[model samples]
Target: MTDLLIRPAHHHDHDAIWSILEPILRAGEAYALPRDWDRERALAYWFAPAHHVFVAEDAGAVRGSYTIRANQLGPGDHVANGAYATHSEARGRGIARAMGLHSFETARSLGFAAMQFNLVVATNSHAVALWTSLGLREIGRLPGVFRHPRYGPVDALVMHRSL
Candidate 1:
């Protein structure tokens, strides 16, 4: 098993985070983010100072990353929101799982009573199963919520778990 270390992201880790996120975005799978989004915009959207983001580093290189924040403002702020991406080469090594667990812990520590994934793409069965295995439930589905480049329009699942 890989010895992964999860930690807050520093300014230097932006490129490493991009290395994992760019392909996932370009592939237009899983996430609802725009396919043609550029690196600069993606960096600003995912790694900006307003959000709490982390990187998973193994053997001195970043192989994955995740971002967590309040799901909404005011009354809904008690719920947490998160997103994760791992390098394709790192698949099946439990990198995403580790990041997910780490994010859960961080969210709880930050006083969020629950965590919610607002838009999990239905075509990405791997992620759906992973979230299920982690005890999150599919509470709702938004039909044709994501426009996948290869699969065309697909449903998006909204998942939630109590912290």
Candidate 2:
């Protein structure tokens, strides 16, 4: 594994961040995002004012990105939610794992009591295994909830772990 530097994303990282996110969004395999979403809207959603965005840089290139925010409003705000994306070429290099660990620590520092992934596409087996290995348990499952591009409607799991 390379020395991955995880840091808060800045305005100048827009292009680099999008480079890592676009392919994943287009694939429509891991996330529930609209496949036809344009770059501007995608960037806006990922870098929204309320989100704490960060990027994993390896050898000066952004290999992955993730965003952390309150899972919901009011009473449910104590739980944090997050999304992650790694460049296709960066897979199997531990970028996602590094980012997940960073998000866990960041979430705790932000005062969240726990972290939850509202929708983890069941078809994304690698992510399921990774999150599980990281100590997040499958708290709930919404059967046939995600419309995967390749595989018809698939189940989505709600994973949670104390921060």
Candidate 3:
């Protein structure tokens, strides 16, 4: 874990970032994105002007990535929102946790007062556990909001934490 470097993403990282994103999206389990989304569309969302994108590199190879952005505009922008992804081969290595911690700091540094995840899939136990461990509390639950590929219609959690 000490070997991991979390830094702002560069233009050259599009391919690496897409590589990490494809499988996750294709699986249609963790995130709500379309399974057939092309690289251009995925990269556009990841690198959107409002998103502060980053990548985690270990031994000079990109292994994970995340994006921090305002949860909304105007009055709500004070609260930040984030999304994360890791290389399939790099799971269980603490990359997501490390990235989550870094994201809080990065969001706070960007003047956000808090962080919120609007639609965390309830079936994703790993993410729910990590967010709780990181001090985010479940503020609300939307029943059957996420249609998990295997689990059918599953609940979603709205989680938040003050930065």
Candidate 4:
């Protein structure tokens, strides 16, 4: 794999970041986002005020991106939640794993005591396996919750790890 740099996303990186996010959102398989989400709205969601976004770059090209934010409001604020997306051409390159690790450290630095992935699409075995390997365990399962575009009503897992 090439040298990958994980850094805080800048305002100018919007286009490159969107290139990685667009396909993932449109796929409607991994995330619970709208399939027909437009670019403007999608960008707004990814860069929402509550999220701290980051990107993985290789040779100055954005390869992946992620967002870190509080999992809930008020009393549940100590736990962090994150979402990741890798560019189609950059899969299998360990970009997601690197981003996950970085996100954990970032979460800790931001005063988060734990990290929770509230909606890990069950059919996304790669991600499930990755999170498991990273020491996150399935804490809960929502049966037939995710209406996966291809897999129909599939389960969604809640994976969590104490920081």
What TM-score would every model get versus the actual structure? 0.97, 0.98, 0.98, 0.98
Cα TM-score of candidate 3: 0.98
Per-residue lDDT for 1-163 in model 2, tens only?
5678999999999998888888888898988889878889999999888899999999999889999999999999999999999988999999999999999999999999999999999989999999999999999999999998888999999999998
Q: Which stretches of candidate 1 lie above 4 Å from their native place?
A: none
Q: Scored by CA lDDT, what does every candidate get?
A: 0.91, 0.93, 0.95, 0.94
**lDDT at position 91, candidate 3:** 86
Please write out the lDDT profile of model 3 over residues 36-114, one tens digit for every residue.
Answer: 8999999999999999999999888999999999999998999999999999888889999999999999999999999
Q: Over the full model, what C-alpha lDDT does candidate 2 score relative to the true structure?
A: 0.93
For model 4 the local lDDT of residue 43 reads 90
Cα displacement (angstroms), candidate 4, residue 105, comes to 0.2
Candidate 2 residue pairs in clash (backbone atoms < 3 Å): none
Instruction: Encode model 1's per-residue lDDT on 1-163: one tens digit a residue.
Output: 3578999998899888888889999898877788779889999999766589999988888999999999999999999999999999988999999999999999999999999999999999999999999999999999998988888889999999999
Q: What is the lDDT of candidate 4?
A: 0.94
Alpha-carbon shift of residue 71 in model 4 (angstroms):
0.3
Against the true structure, what is every candidate's RMSD?
0.9, 0.8, 0.8, 0.7
List the candidate 2 regions with Cα displacement exceeding 4 Å: none
